[model samples]
Target: MQYAIPAPPPWWSRLLARMSPTEDMPTRGRHPRALVTPHHDEPRPTLAELYRARRLDMVRLALFLVDDLHTAEDVVQDAFAAVCRHHGTSLDGLQDPAAYLHTAVVNAARSVLRRRRTARGHTPPHAGYGPPVDEGLLLAEEHRQVLDALAQLTRRQREVLVLRYWSELTEAQIAKTLGLSRGTVKSTASRALDALEKKLKVVR
Candidate 1:
């Protein structure tokens, strides 16, 4: 039986509508003063618009960081909520809203990892379950090995590798996002790749 595709969320439609371009008319008849004065009351994009625009990509990023879809969604939600609380309707005021959202999601994912670590420490040794076989099947064996090894690295190393390779961010962007020096980001990423290779028993 054929199934209908799910419609895009309401916020997604609104975001698309907001992004639609309008034709510019001749301003020859308008007063010059009107152009010089910034409209303080102009309707700017809000946290909701940003969220609708970026939520899926942000959640995917969090998933790479945290390795759990539910946790990733929670992380993204918390990130957006934090942005809302901080910026409200003035999201456009931020110099780089996308960068801010990326930083917020990373921070939230780190918090989730910290909490999971603490909980794991308190739990019985046999309480943990193995990852699902379907998840393993989703990637090629080499890719799976890489991810397994990636998970075994230090949190900083994993962050560096994931942000660099998975997110395809430049070293400078990673450094800015993670609040690290450019040299530090380069060294950390190199070390992370080395450690991952060692874990996967790769010659390179």
Candidate 2:
């Protein structure tokens, strides 16, 4: 998966100005919140490696939310930028770095949804997808169906579904990510699932 990254102006590029380090996350066109490189310092490999590790999964998660392959990249860039902004201390203490990145991607997608109420065009369905092509994607068809079902949902529903089924985050985690109450997360996820179930039955 990937996080969101910002794009520079086309005219600026003509002057050949220094560009920020671009870690390719799957977000389409924008990045926000990643800390700018320190004026006089090289980032260490450990942190770089950690970011590299999380990028692809973040991309996948972003793709899930955005649906369009193009926009997915933009969404992830924004997420990573956000991660950079509040990248407190180190990622060393987290029990699961992947989970952290996963949440980040989800949050980024939500931000995108807020900015643009609807995602236009096709977002490839997660649940209905064929087996993952990369060595990384291990989702089965049934699982794919689950993801597909989630994809059919509105942004809020998709966010709740990812928390409940994909990330297995607690209702509290879902609430915190979506800025909803735990009760709301629980209720929304329930409703989203009910909606997904109906959609899945028809497709199946």
Q: What RMSD does each model have against the real structure?
A: 14.4, 15.1
| Count: clashes, candidate 2 | 38
Q: Candidate 1 overall Cα lDDT vs. reference?
A: 0.65
Model 1, range 34-62, lDDT digits (tens) per residue?
A: 22223566444567666655676676678
Clashing pairs in 1: none
TM-score of each: 0.69, 0.54
Q: What TM-score, to 2 decimals, does candidate 2 have?
A: 0.54
Best by TM-score: 1
Candidate 1 local lDDT, residue 126: 92
Give the lDDT of residue 21 in candidate 1.
26
Report every candidate's CA lDDT: 0.65, 0.55
lDDT of 2 by residue, 41-133 (tens): 433223455566556556655765765445667787776666556663363434444445666788777777665543333444553323334
